[model samples]
Target: MDFSLFAEEYFDEVLRLLRHLCTIPAPSGEEDERVRFCQEYLAELGIEATLDPAKNLLWTLGAPSQRVTLFMAHTDTVFPRATPLKLADDGTFLRCPGVGDDTANLAVMLACVRCIVEKKLPLHRTLLFAADSCEEGLGNLKGCRQIFADWGDRIDRSISLDCSYRGVYCRSVGSHRYQITAETEGGHSYFAFGNKSAILPLAEITCQIYEIEPPVVGNSKTTYNVGILSGGTSVNTIPQSATMLAEYRSDHRECLAEMETRFAQIFSRAKEACPRLTVERVGDRPCMGEVDPRALDELSHRAAGLIQKYTGICPEFRSGSTDCNIPHSLGIPAIAFGLYDGGGFHTTEEWLRKDSLKPGFCIGLEMILREGEAE
Candidate 1:
């Protein structure tokens, strides 16, 4: 098949969609403007689109059927509400804080739908295209969670376009995020010289957790990190309170469980060392496991072959989590793929390689077509 033909015919429309999505600032929990834009765009394309109560935009092609294939991408970006979005001077890149992270994925999803419609292809199963919300930080995977809660049983296969680059992520790297806090009675350093300090306990606990070797089972390697810490007031006064935000990630669920057990043990030890100290667990995000290995391998092989045939780079397994985690946890066949070459995400320096869009779009379309035919 001549993939370039598909690219040539859809280049203009894809660029137009990318420009429209780049201009909208749809940060997490605030995707109203972007949702409206997508609804109108889908309407123009003659696809039936609706915005659910959770503010997710769902577009369907063809009639509702028992066999359904879902194409998902979050409309929310990591950028702030007032970030000014503009095309760069070079006319090749979109210059904005969150343009590459998710906006690019949203645009690519729209482009794929446009291609399917413009080509007049007959789809056996219903195509569910969603521009979901609440994907970053505490927004949690609420948007996708709702979709699965509402319509999970009907979906035979699903894919999320939130990779921010051209890659196929079939393996799920589950993660557990925790906010740990310790508090103690406050007093001046000189006056409280013999008293237990919250900072001391927190530091000791952190050291113990890090010093322990992370578990390794099969292909999965467990990892832990204390990403954020805060507590002390001044040099002369002992800190009364301290907090550390930590996370554990592994491809295997057993690894996560083992780490969790170790963490609890360390916390308990800290409490024994400092009688005045108190500990609290604040928040967590569950890890995503791999889909059926055979199914995942087949899809990966097909996707990698197509990508190599077009872009000369075979796609590889990714360890990051996305909306796919929600469905993958539900035992649904899901993967996250992207259409741009995004680097330095969540920063002003983030950029997308414009040339990647064309080939990426073709690959996405090919994957959808193959998936629709798969039994």
Candidate 2:
């Protein structure tokens, strides 16, 4: 379908909405303001959006039907509440902390909802619009898990607005995250020169963990990283506690299990070196190995066709761990697609190309319309 007229009329408005959204601090578990903004924004368009206990903002269109399709984008960012979401617009790019990842997609979701309402499109099935929270960091996909837990049976299919606009995620990459801590007696560095420090064991564990070389098989690979490490007080003091946050991701369930087993063994070996080492798993996202559902595959191909038609780029289908992981693991048909061209994910320099917004918005709009027609 031609999207020129729609883009001409709503492109600026969508960017404005996105700028407004980017300025709001909606770090996981603290998305009240963003959720409230979405509720009021949709309410002004005569759509009553509701906020669930999980802090997910949701709205529905058309009459209730057995074939329900959900379109979702996460509202949370890896950045904390104190991190500034400064928007820098130099006419070609909009730079912000989360402009590319979910914020851009979230804007696209809102834009599609608004467009559908404005066009007064004929709807044959239920269309559920969701802005879920807690998809990043320690939040552990709580919002999405809640979405499926509460409405899995009735929902026919779901889509996540995530990753890159250049591809569709057909497989879910599972992950296991943990917080490893080491505690010991604290003393002055001069006096404690011969005693064991918490930092020593943390460093040993991190080194041991990183020493592991992941095996890549077919489409799946096992990988690990230590993302954060913090400890110590004064420079002259031997700190009593040190902690590191580490995680492993793999498309194969067996690989994940094996990695966990290795991690346990590594921790056990580290404890012998420092007696007080402890490992606590904090996050787990299940992988749906190499999904090839015919219906969803058709949907993906249709989306890829639109991407090529509008942007001249052949969209790729790949695996990723996203909010769709929960539903996909539950045997519900789900996939993740991206919005906008950008980079610097999970960093302060995240940005989205200004030119990509319009096409991305159109792609999402069409994807939603097509998914709603699924049999």
Candidate 3:
């Protein structure tokens, strides 16, 4: 399969598909509509597609062996359904919410599969393309978990199309997300000033969480964040309850475990001060598990080589928490690489250059076809 020729012929079709997909409101956990659209689009292209229990769209092409090469692009974005998408195509860039992060990559993945079927490309390995759901905040990679659960045994290796073109992630980052709430006796601000207040304990916990330094183990780094904090019945009333959402992430399992210990101590102290406090674990993402060092290096280098071939740029190798996390944790060699050049991901200002689509598609196609070779 000559991706250069394929891109020259189908570039417009892929771009049009990307633009259309960006307009749809496929927020995390609400990706049914977008997945349905993609399934129908593949149907029109003479490809059969299905939705797993977790709503991951799956399309496969068989070979002699049951072992398969997996290609995945998450379909959901960080934006909500009500986010107003204002597209600005300045004849150089296409700017809009959810346009770059994984939306464009999903379209590119679909396009490559379409090209393979259309060109009657011969295959040595079975190929599976997955457009998955719930990759954004709070959704916690449920889509990918199902993908591995359904087909882990037969998966030879996997590649996730995501992020920007400058970097590719080989190791999976681990994370733990938690929601804490404090309850206490309530009264008017002036009258119940002496009463146990819910806000005080939660406030102290938030401060203490920031006080702990992030862990740095070798090249791996850990980070902490308090994303949402809300409480109080009224401005004038003493708060009866308060709640906070917080998380910690690390590229090393030891660092994640260390943070978990520190977090437990923090919550334990708070619990002693306020017996009514409650803590719930909301999300747990896996770190890279034991795998052959050479296998990991081989997959990462292969993807990076293709990117440099297409774009004339060296790609960075790093670790990240993405859809590849599941496969990587299962000891399968997986890497998440970008299919396009873009920035401002997970924000309304997200954009990608219009002209980079061809090279990006070329790289993605090569990644799909082993060694970029056609028999």
Q: How would you encode candidate 3's per-residue C-alpha lDDT over 206-268 as one tens digit per residue?
A: 999999998787888899999988999998888899999999998887899999999999999
Models, CA RMSD each: 2.5, 2.7, 2.0
Predicted structure 3: clash tally:
0
What is the Å distance of residue 265 in model 2 from its true position?
2.5
- Say which candidate scores most in TM-score: 3
Cα displacement (Å) at residue 252, model 1: 0.6
Better of 2 and 3 by lDDT: 3
Identify the runs in model 2 with alpha carbons over 4 angstroms from their true place: 186-197, 210-217, 229-239, 269-275, 289-292
CA lDDT of each prediction against the hidden true structure: 0.76, 0.84, 0.87
* Model 1, runs deviating above 4 Å: 164-166, 271-283, 288-290
Summing lDDT over every window of 10 consecutive residues in candidate 1, give the lowest-scoring window: 277-286
lDDT for position 239 in model 3: 86
| Tens-place lDDT digits, model 2, residues 141-193 | 99999888888888877888886678888777899998988999989999778
Candidate 3 lDDT (Cα, 0 to 1): 0.87
Window of ten residues with lowest summed lDDT in model 2:
287-296
What TM-score, to 2 decimals, does candidate 3 have?
A: 0.94
Residue range 10-94, candidate 1, lDDT tens digits: 7777777777787788778889998999899888988778888888988777555877878888888787877777757266765
TM-score for each candidate, following the candidate numbering: 0.90, 0.89, 0.94
Candidate 1 global TM-score = 0.90
